[model samples]
Target: MPASAPAQPIKLVIWDLDDTFWRGTLSEGSVEALAENLQLVRDTAARGLVHTIVSKNDFAPAEARLRELGIWELFVFARISWQPKGPIIKELLSQMQLRAANALFLDDNPANRAEAQFYNPELRVADPTELPQLVPLLRASGQPDPTLARLAQYKLLERQQQARTQYDDNLAFLRDAQVQVEFREGPAAVLPDLGRLEELINRSNQLNFTKRRVTLPELEASLRDPTRRWGTVRVHDRFGDYGLVGIYCLNEAENRLEQLVFSCRILHLGIEQFTYAHLGFPVLAVQGDVATELNQTEKPDWITVQAASAATETPAVVATPTGQQLRVLLKGGCDLGQLTPFLQAFDLDVAEEFNFNNEHQIPVHLEHTLLLRATREWPAAEQQRLAAALPFLGREAFDTRLWEPGYDVLVYSPLMDYTQPLYCERATGRRVPFGAYQDITAEPPAALAARYAQRRFQGMSEGFLQRFAREFEHEGPISPAEFQQNLQWLRAQVPAHVPIFLLSGAEIDVPGSGETGARQRHELMNQALAEFVASAENCFLLDVRAFVQTPADVTNNLRHYHRRHYRALAQQLAQAIGAWQGQGLGHSPWADLKARAVGLLPAKLRGLLGR
Candidate 1:
């Protein structure tokens, strides 16, 4: 406040993951995948912008992930605990002993970015993926100190230390420390202050997820629409405080609920999408009455006017691990050929699809499949639906369970639920692979190793597989309209119980310049990717090089590297789907393996872990 006080030198750049820099939650992948933007960070810091990470995860996992990815050194300070990132960010400035004027805060969350701007209008907000061009924007006027360059080597050490601590009981550690999120329905006016909302958006990952970001005024106007129903989800409990973490928007027409989606933050609270679903059901009931009154005609074919029966049963609800479910029913993709071998490796039985004996009253379940039949070509709408899903397109959607109509599986899930996926495969636009692992389950590692040897003996006659592979190229960034349409199709399938998953990958050719890869427009691809993933619950966008892709079938990849990792993915997918309680469920072995792995850690760490 004093004119005489020399302004504190702008010394730091705070980073928020999720929608800020890259798209999707980084925690959803392996360390290899999480560090997709490492080069960008290193170069930025070298230009004198001090880097830091501010997130809402427990300190241990966040720290471990950073270290595993070998990017820890780029951050001068990291506040990765369960505290609301806004306050932690303020504290970070203090701890680093810097002033708001001297530090530029960055994050991918609209709320976090908005809140940072609200609290400190001067703070520089950014998406980590935009750093290449951003640095020039920051230093367009002059030269910068290069001391940060030396910090890169230290990053490797951080990763080494993280690798050392990873297995020390992650589950016990998580269970012992739980983040209980509570929610409530309220008028739009109840939204949190700008700063608080920003904190929630940026730091509140894992639940209340959404990709559609509207400015506060835009949010209010949308809510005020006569034909639109809006609901707000407030989050609070234990870890600092994340206020107003979720929002759902739906348009009601003749008797149908359309355009339903909510923030991904409060997904677990069941307050956002559930509220939207509840709202849509009433409109549907009203429509039925209108039809009866207008026609006075005998009730049409399909079971109609079972108003009370409908209220008691929500047949379809889609969700991803992020917690948000759709108000519309979506058909899950089916790939029959991929499902059998994938499931076999895990030693689980899968039905081709699900059948609801509404008369007998069987709860909706995504029955697994045992075999593949005649190939049915998938509808263009469905194919387009998933391509829009991006990184979150898991094995459930990408593997055999996903049908291409006559060319694919024939089974159908009641509500398209894609919380987790086994693996997402994309043909690289580029040249050769270093090595690809083959999946081997149902046998000890040694026995599997023998199988590999036998396969190798046979393969030697053919050739090495990785030798023919190469890095992937740019298919160009996916569009938001593509995703919006995908959401609408998902709603049309059944009762709105399905959740959608999205994935995106970025390629950095010449790191900085903000233009890289094929299209060369830096932020466009990442931003579009973020928006797409955010539109769904627990959506994921994997960096092509960031996370290692785990193949569903051993033969899918020549190396046969399945068991050490394949089972873990199955559990993650199952848990994401399991959030809904009635679906998910590939098999228990994957879950059991995951539990066992966590059990192997120290009790303290295990106490803090969860699927």
Candidate 2:
């Protein structure tokens, strides 16, 4: 039986790797790569269609085979484990931030396709034998993406999702992400992206608040109309750039939004809410149930306006550079590493000093305020002895770039103080920051060592774990009063002229997350942070609670958030930095374009280019 035509154009192609993508099963023997299938993926991907995998094979070998076939990186959110096809496909779509209707699953097994359709009633599924009939339609699905920019954006989202899992706290992840948005208006700007505007207006459903559809000619005319205010939204974060992901048109005469639409790619980043707020919450008569609800009062502070829109009350002044980039030192968890790319988009020289696995294979976090004080006040002998004795604190544990004088500004997150527990040394009464919540000393050495071994951490043997338990006592998280005092000390330590931009913690409860009373803890700490920032000179707070409010806003815990939030956080950081400097940071359009273009290159070529 022939598969019926889908109601929506296919944006994603889910493959069954065993007999569908290749000739045979990898678990049994070597499988032959299908040339036609390979060509179809390459061609459709270039046309902005995404591809993924759903296979009942070991992830490692299957991924290795795909890489060998030179198409591994082309797919996002690949589910290769031995899981039920139906549930996995449903979850995969949710993770990819895509809808079932916009995805097509191709499998060799009739049972597998039926299971997928059963799980997702709107999902379109077909047998692998239908490729000959569906090839042209698949190739013709998406618009031309010469740079494979859409594929690259999905890859960026893939990297972000991978990173989000590492964090236990969703708000913490978002605060470190550093998301930014640029709104471009006028015919000179919005007209060039006419095709994207048309697609977003007509095809977008979930985020298409107004449900307004317009043809190319109609859109072109609307852009030129004096009665309408039109704009395009471009976003970039620590992950990568999402170029022109949204469009908005307001009927100025009636103070209503005529057309408000965005690609599902930018979902959960609060782009739509931010855009509505940016437009002063114009009267938008929503046609149907939309993914986001627009409110008149709340404006998402996480998202910063990079380019001034016509609606901006006070336009930022783009700074004239002095032939040199402002040196910025970003210090936080390794998760903040996402902010580097987005921060570099501005006229700033970014330097990252994040947590890393030391030579002992123990992950060392150096961003703690207690550790910062130790770096300055602790005797050299004490520092060296602790660094050598403790696997958690390697030789470089006490070392930091904070003392360096070259950097002009400091972008810091004091989340370690909010999350990490303090361990006091028995001999010298010196306090050290390590781990979070759980008392590692209480756990059996065998169990602790086994956990460490699973993580491939060396030097954390049973004997060493026993010794660590004996020598150090867990002191719990830092007290708010002590936290404030430390902040004062840090302010005194840094040069007064250099402004310190601090990121505050989110205070939302994540129900299933085992961290009981974490929200209350964050609330207490947030208050302490706010008090410090209010009184302290040259200190500003980037409060994440402004946007990361609901449980749905986070992932596993209160600290980690969806990828889009990171882009919004980056923009807020840039805007705050600009305010401190009395001018907006110089944006590199070519740098952003180059970043997107780099994704379009072939995987081999991208690796060769060292991207």
Candidate 3:
């Protein structure tokens, strides 16, 4: 096979690590890290292009090396091993749900590239020497995706694929997936996504049934035309949300489909056939070589139409008095501070109560259930004495807006309980949750102080570290039983009428993250949290595991997620809140869009803009 220009835009870039992604072979010696390749991966990834490895190397060493280089998390569905490159690349593309024609394979060896092309005839092949010419084109390929939402979606697909392999029966996997589709009809619903509609109509091929392309002006006109019933299809499953995957234009006047197209991302999900059946199996003039054959009688039993929530469909019955905003106090780790703006987009007045640096220059986290209990139960003298004794806990740490009656609703995350280790005061036998995984008292004071210093943490001086070690006994993270007990106590503390929504942790393994067994820890905590929510009144669980399934879904650790996921989380939180209130919360699409755009800005710029 000879190399030719891709028929479609390159959506994926497959890299051969040795002498290609980096300078030298890993099996032989330390490879010189390629600065250009590193930056290219970052730049191209931000623009929605997916990258993966198809190198013929040992998996462990190659993974460790990639981790050392700080680019291990960027790639998904990595196929690194001493395997034939040709067959591996072909299978890799299949698993990634990508077409070979829309993928570029880069290898330094001409023979490797030739072999890959032989297996995948349409795959674009390039030598490392061509990167100087190819970098610009690759960078310009995808639309601006500052949050790497596209990358996240593909990661979701990768997870789904991996899980699918576990089941020998495909139908069983689909059934277990719990696939759901939501259809949006009418001009008001479909017009806002005019750009996406146009793109799918023109760019999609494998599932483009009518093959009727339209310009933006024509699309806008057709959407308004009463004769055409246009609808957009959104799909989600146990895996994650696949937003607006398919579009259909039904000619009601003739009972024929003018347009029925879907992104290949939803291929094999039976969405096309599902959508056709949902639309009463409209007469469709079949286009050339569609991946799926549509039939009139069979609708996929695996996929069910997700019913629009009563709150979302109708004006929300305000929980407070008329014209008053619902006061929501969000309490959690500082990372959850990202959800405030998105939550505020709904008809709610949001107040944040996150951990902050105290007078002793140490960060104090107060969201722990025990701390919440101490705020009211502990005597003033005792509180002051402990506040003075422990640098990690300040006088203000015991104070929280949670006890204040000013707020009507509470959005709380008990992640600190899930991640932090507890230390007991030898004198009082009172336990206080602090750092994660490590016992502070067990570490040498000098080493601990130096580690804290590197993080620019103050007040963890050698003197304080020594004093702390002498006085406090290390107790590991809270057990699931104790966690449930605390949850019960907290519920009793808050008023019965007030709704408490808890944000659960992501139970995904983050590779290269030093936090060992974090996913297992989260799974344990999440189960306890779910059990508590099931029995507790007015308590809800904003489950993140549905969307945050892979290592790539999180950053650095399991507790923190990519910025875009925060928006999805906020949306989930709002819906749960609305359902509790017995009405849908009002939303500002403009505000949501603005937040998304702001999320794309550089961190410094976002900070300067006060986002």
Candidate 4:
């Protein structure tokens, strides 16, 4: 038995007839068609290429010449128009359901080639004379070319177009097309080519959601996530199988859709709607500059919309006072210090004089210690030492006493306190270990009243317990349920006008030499902490975990950030504070004037005038 001819992968081969496919323009004079050029079209078409013609000529004259050469039917599409060649080529490629990136556009006129390349830069443009050279290059791509499937699909579209009574009624045609879609869920095993999903997601533009391009390892990790669902969509019709054309990864826990992408080759085929429908098509909330196919092409009715009751509620805006320095009290381990420069830039003062009166720095580990000492749970020597150091307020000191540390804002974090042990180094380079307090039992709510009592003895003044507390609870490695209850009590102690900004922590850990059990605890605590912050009614939570990538971005030790990390931290803090303030941090009178001046003009007039 004789071997069948191998299918050519190149989908379409477009030819320009005037002085390109033939010796001269048919309209100007009698043009002689080159035998080799004619054979090139015939051979390419026979090898499963959809040969097409685009030329500047009278349609009748061009068709007559093609008919004389007995090759008119070989061309699936022919455009003899006075309009620009670029747009016509785009239409032809779209009609054929082929990507411009894969098709070859051959024209002798440099101007025509430039026009086509301009419209779709991905198109492979070459002079007809380069046919001998281009054939080998096409073969080198090594794709198994399916013969004439594109042409048959194009013919079906053309028949549908002819049958339509009205123009531009694509919805009617799409409905009548009898499109069949097979939606597959879970893992790369469902895909015919595993890497194809990655390629489609990375390459697709108009259909992308997050526009996140991932490596194979990342894709594998996503598939492995218990909360994530992976989907692959293969579309076909009575006309042909379009192959696996769409892929998406959905995070069920966050209700976030990531990297939803489809091949533009199947742009108008309703594959996108079919795929999203399988996953219960989510209501898209536009973020940034996402240019989806729905934004470009006509909108379809088949989109899966989330339930009405599931919609996110808008947060109530808090009113902030204008024109006063934002007095911020720093708490938390060490990262709180990183916010100093950014805070100062925004007229947020953190100096001792600006701090609430009677506020004294206490070691984080000693927080539990102070609880013991104030409750008289400390040993005799320790109790006496603490009593002498802070005599004004203790169990025996005073009735109805308050720890006054006056500040408009408080920033605190228990991240380092929960994650690591505390210690003080001596001048001789000897290290003194402060106990981790992992064994310390949770104290009663009534026991923490004197947390700041040591400072009250120094004759400082102001709200000892009523100042607004601001905390960056960036991920802590420990989950203390009592800590959450403490936040509610703290909010209750502060004035109603005071804001409790709880900035959430980032994912700061990298894989290291640690017990597997410890790692598991850290992950659980991080997740629980996020949920806790989000649920706080009186707290303004700034989830900074979105900013942390690899542990190196925020910190070297995964707990404390380097000074270099301050730039990003500052910017995030600035945005968060701006929102909390109801305006920008550095909003001066001059900047306001400039903004007002710009806002006065009509949008078009402003654009014309320039900024």
Candidate 5:
């Protein structure tokens, strides 16, 4: 028994001109082409097949006829000449870097088809009438075809190529194109587009990291699996939008890159670098053929890794109808409390400390309650000390109801000094002057004068190092490692999208004396605060000291802002909101262009250009 013909993958299909491509010949007969055949070429190409013409006629008139039919550009690598069909098809295939076995040749004349097959035996020869039936059979592989979309992508790519000649450097051409890339992950990903992903994976010869193929059903199963994380990317620029051009999958637990594939149309853009950087993952160094080639090229310096911190000092944001409503959780120093009204004036939702007096100071009982909840384990003596101080402390734990989650911004300036047992005047019931607190006795504070004597020591005044070690079961002062863990815990309590605005404490003054020690301590605190902000993601430093370098007319206090500075604070808040709004979907280049163009047109013309 003879073996059946092998099922081959068709990369390119060349059409004959005289009688196969259309109803008539170009030179003698009318230049009429069948609209159905033209659509068939477009539809077939859209399925990821490259279509071109192999005509035996004068090049110009034949090209002009195809142009008149509005389908000239659809044909890539067209060869219109009097040369023998076999040699022409062979050259075109060689230039495209495709194999003869992966190509199909269609002609009306049996001699032309026989000659083509004789030269390249693996090439499949078919009658023009057979294409309508043959094309469907060829697409049995079920691979995703992006050829339809490639038409637009290639057009943009051609324009980019042409623009490259105008610039001396490639970076200049890319920058001039004004490309914007947006990455999406989690529930927003297009994992349901399984066929597209499968095609993307198989069609990719150079950049397919894993080179593994999964069917549509298997892909759908992966999307449903909670253990796997997936993401898709969309690219847009001045010329056009390349919708959903890239897809990636990662192991949720291991954070390992499973598959990475992008359309070759965007290879020049250095998308791989941007993708890895934005996702905060290093390149996997997978050993695919294309990956090997990519590794040899010079590393791209033009692509910027997405900023880890959410805050942009001056973002180019467009204005929106409604302003951003942030839930500003004031959890820091008294300065943040004073800034509440100013924040509210800018239409922000302010949630100040709960169960506090007008001064924004936590009473001793409330402090004890907070410490009790925050305390994991403490020495018996330390626990007793807290118990003894309880009667003198206020009853309310800063209202628990006020500690709601999902706050848009957290104003965190935790009172490091106030937490010390000896320095806590609110618990001891004596208002020792602010600068005198460092002088507390060997024992906890009993009177204001004892605080002054305690200041005689050269080290930290409250012996906080010893007390904190015993209470928290830790070995030292708040180390950076501890601060980082605390920050992570705080992040876990809120939504991932919430940004923390850390409020740094104000510079300390001795009131009556210019004590260098007090300035040193304050400077140390500021330095530590800056480092803390740098270590954490989505946390921005809002230096309260920046707004209070000089006292305002309404108040001489250094810790909090005066009413006179509210306008300046409001302006800063407005700019932050505006910057966020500007990054929204409304900021698309197309939208901006339309708005500008419509603005220049007259009312009558605008009516004609109505939405």
Candidate 6:
């Protein structure tokens, strides 16, 4: 059947920039990344796909910046506003005279995509990162695809796939949206991803698929599983190149196609039905001895969210939230994501610091909980430095004035002074061991404090702290052998159940010298790390000496900001929290951490409740 084009002829292919183009925190990023993004948009338009923008941004200032870049005219229409995007997108579609199916909607945020899908189930949804591959499907080239039939279900095509009108999923949404399977098998090789599968998977998910994502290990592991046969297909039709576009994973015992997915970008090219008789799989269900069953898609595990309404709990007799003065410092750093979500979780007012002294202690609406991050991990400098002042005498394109560094400071000692602090290392995704305190014999608090005093004299001073800090740079006062001895001692002391992470980061002065010493330094850094941890009795030591020794990738000096790989570390923290919950760390262990933190701390503190 010939396709029906929109009345407007789609002279422009408009897109939402934030979550659509790439997964990014709307609050911050570098000018360079933003420039590359705009260039990508223009390039897409240049490739015969006219592009436009209908995003939610501050109008005058947003357009002014785009104009400065000389690509403002690329977008024929922009619904820039603070209102909900559903109406905005609908308005654009109506103004452009386009039907839902003909109109392709791209957004990074799942809520926005769902809203558009709810309004018009037939429209195609995608992540902006998938744009380069998806343009073909909308163009005059690609063939008809049935994977799209499932998308209609995701947006309410049928009872099996539609969201309940009232909304009853968080975990289900994640599992369904995030369970990605690729068919990478070659053609004539008897695997699913022969020719057309890769295209379907590329555009399968809009919310979770990161750009340039690769799960090489998982793909390789499937080969060792005799029960499963996995394959990927690379295809290119007469029109253009279709990079590795399909994958297939099947379970021989179950006689089930464990995984069969393709990129949606190349759909409608008549390659959709390769899964049918062409691939030797039936599309319909089996009834007799399961021999006639169709291939089954992979099922994903979903997270379970325990329900608890704040309104149902009895009101505590504590004082209500009150305006109180507090000191805040806006230390420079890279914020891969905004700090607002965390702050809002605690329900507090925040503002930038104007001065560092008591004068800066502006009044904040004090809540029952208030925790300030005095020292977050970040780079030592801002991300964007003036290109001209790069003082490097060596041959280089430009100099970076700022770098994000690792800040290994801990949150205010968690209610207990542990002999060996339980730190979660960003590297290795495991616990590590550090320090010299070797015993926790159920001793009284007084006895523990006394024991701590003796160690404090040796561990807390300038000599010890300096030496500890220098361990990363390989100038620790403790010798290599002594460090190993300490590690053995620590290993003997720690509890087997705990994951101990002992970390010693480094900082190197990258002088005018070239990048020649990096390898040797890497080896030294690795050795120092191995010795540091190997010496500990029961702790895992991460030789982040080399890792943190270099300045941060972000501009912030604090490691918590997007500097020192903040998001990656945050994920580790999240996992640790998940692990902690799994280990039964709280009353509800699974109760919402943010909610419980705000509600339980006051009771746990006995008398220090704040309002």
Candidate whose TM-score is highest: 3
Candidates arranged by TM-score, highest first: 3, 2, 5, 4, 1, 6
How does candidate 1 fare on TM-score?
0.25
User: What is the C-alpha local distance difference test score of each model?
Assistant: 0.38, 0.79, 0.82, 0.52, 0.54, 0.36
Error of 1 at 92 (Å): 35
In candidate 6, stretches whose alpha carbon ends up further than 4 angstroms from where it belongs are 1-51, 54-221, 252-255, 282-611
Best by lDDT: 3
Sort the candidates on lDDT, descending order.
3, 2, 5, 4, 1, 6
Candidate 3, 492-583: lDDT as tens digits: 88887787878888877788888887788988887677656644555666767656878888888888899899998898777666655656
User: Candidate 3 at 547: error in angstroms?
Assistant: 38
| lDDT, candidate 1, 1-611, per-residue tens | 12122244445667665555345565675323434366656655544456777875566766766677677756755667656666677666554434577666666566776776676655656655555555455553212224232233224323332343554764333333233333322332222122223333443323322434444335434544677655444433222223334544456555443322333322223334344444444332221111012112232121112221122221233223453331211222232222233333332333444223222121222321111111123554654453343211222332343432221111232111111111222442211111112222222545544544564322211122222112132222223333333433432332233333232222233323222232233234334344433333323322222222323322232112234333433333333333333344445456565655664677578657631
Local accuracy of candidate 5 as per-residue lDDT tens digits, 1-611 = 01133476676677887778887877896956777778777666644577777878898988888888888988876778888888877876655545788777888899998888777778877887776677565554222233254445555655665576689987888777776666655522343233355567756766677677775446656765788778776676666655556778887677777777786666767787677656556346575576324433344555432321221221222222465465667664444444554455455566765323322232222322224234333445554554443322222322343246545655555444322223333333322112222332333533433443354322222444344323332111233334434555565554545665555555645354433344455555555445444334445554444344543322433344554454454444444443343331222345434544653678588557643
- Could you estimate the TM-score for every candidate? 0.25, 0.50, 0.53, 0.37, 0.41, 0.24
Give the Å shift of residue 587 in candidate 6: 58
TM-score between candidate 6 and the true structure? 0.24
Better of 2 and 5 by TM-score: 2
Model 3 bad stretches (over 4 Å): 1-7, 310-611
**Which tens-of-lDDT digit does each residue in 180-260 have in candidate 4?**
665556432232134456556665665676678886447656765778878766665545545556777777877767757
Score candidate 5 by TM-score against the native: 0.41
List clashing residue pairs in candidate 5: 46-148, 206-290, 317-582, 318-582, 364-393, 365-393, 365-394, 439-451, 439-454, 439-455
Give the per-residue lDDT digits (tens) of candidate 2, residues 1-611. 26555667889999999889999989999999999999999888866799999999999999999999999978888998988999999988887888898898999999998899899988888888988888878887875553466777788888778887888987677666676788877654555345457667877888899998886447767777989999988777788766667889999999999988988777777788888998999999999988888788887677767744422212222343568888889998766665666677788898989999899787888998999999999999999998888888899988898987878888888988988888888887988888776778889999989999999988889999798878888889988868877888898898877778788788888889887778888878876676566445566676666568789888887777654566567767777676556557788877655545654677587567644
